[model samples]
Target: MKIAWLTLCAPLLLSACTSTQTVGYGPNLEPIPGSITYGGQPRTKLTKAPVGSIVPHQFFDDFGHRVYETYVIEPDRSLRLTSRRIDYDIFND
Candidate 1:
């Protein structure tokens, strides 16, 4: 009886722990200003990088904000923007 109950509950507990939420924005999303993909998705595909690879890009935006973006290479050779971080030089660093 205990083993049967454990077996029945195990799948529910495991499924609850599995994450369905994405880490960040999905692919082909409208780019936000100061992001690397603000203009559009890059024409060059990440042919060399493997799927699920994390790529980092950094640059300064039009308003002088430093932008750092993280992307994951997809199976189709497109990049999915995962997360973006912006830092303003408030202290002139």
Candidate 2:
């Protein structure tokens, strides 16, 4: 019984480990006003930076909030924003 169960589960476990998740922009990944890719990816594609390399950008949003963003270069030579942080400047107000 145990041998049969292991045989049944082995392929499932190995398949799970072998699956690769593709990273790309989705509906929820809409860029903000001051983002680098806000108006869509630049006509000039990155060549020197290898795929999976991280690029950081800082800018002030339309609301005057400091925004820090981290992006990764995809296989297609496009930048994909992976993480973002906003500084509200609570004390400055």
Candidate 3:
């Protein structure tokens, strides 16, 4: 009887020890990539910009949806946006 009880309770105890918590951004909360800037300058890089170099930029928007833009460094040390996209929540779908 004790062996049978242990077998049944073992699964329950192991399951309880496991965590189902989610980490990082949720499905609804997505990350939007913004433009890239080097130092305090916009569309400008301190070093020579390569064709496929990436720069990081941060900004906040008033809208609820997340807005992001991606920029690629040009040979001229300038930044150009390759593409832009927006993430929004839709109801009544």
lDDT of 3 by residue, 1-93 (tens): 999999999988877543332212322333343325324336435485557686544353355444455555667666655544544444311
Which ten-residue region of model 2 has the weakest summed lDDT? 18-27
Please, what is the whole-model Cα lDDT of each candidate in the order they appear?
0.70, 0.77, 0.50
Better of 2 and 3 by TM-score: 2
Query: Clashing residue pairs in candidate 3, if any?
Result: none
lDDT of 1: 0.70
Q: Which is better, 1 or 2, measured by lDDT?
A: 2
Q: Where does model 3 exceed 4 Å of error?
A: 1-44, 56-59, 90-93
- TM-score of every model? 0.59, 0.66, 0.41
Return the top candidate by lDDT: 2
* Candidate 3 structure, TM-score to reference: 0.41
Model 3 poorest 10 in a row by lDDT: 18-27
Q: After superposition, which runs of candidate 1 have C-alpha atoms over 4 Å from their true positions?
A: 1-30
Q: Count of backbone clashes for each model?
A: 0, 0, 0
**Candidate 2: residue pairs that collide:** none
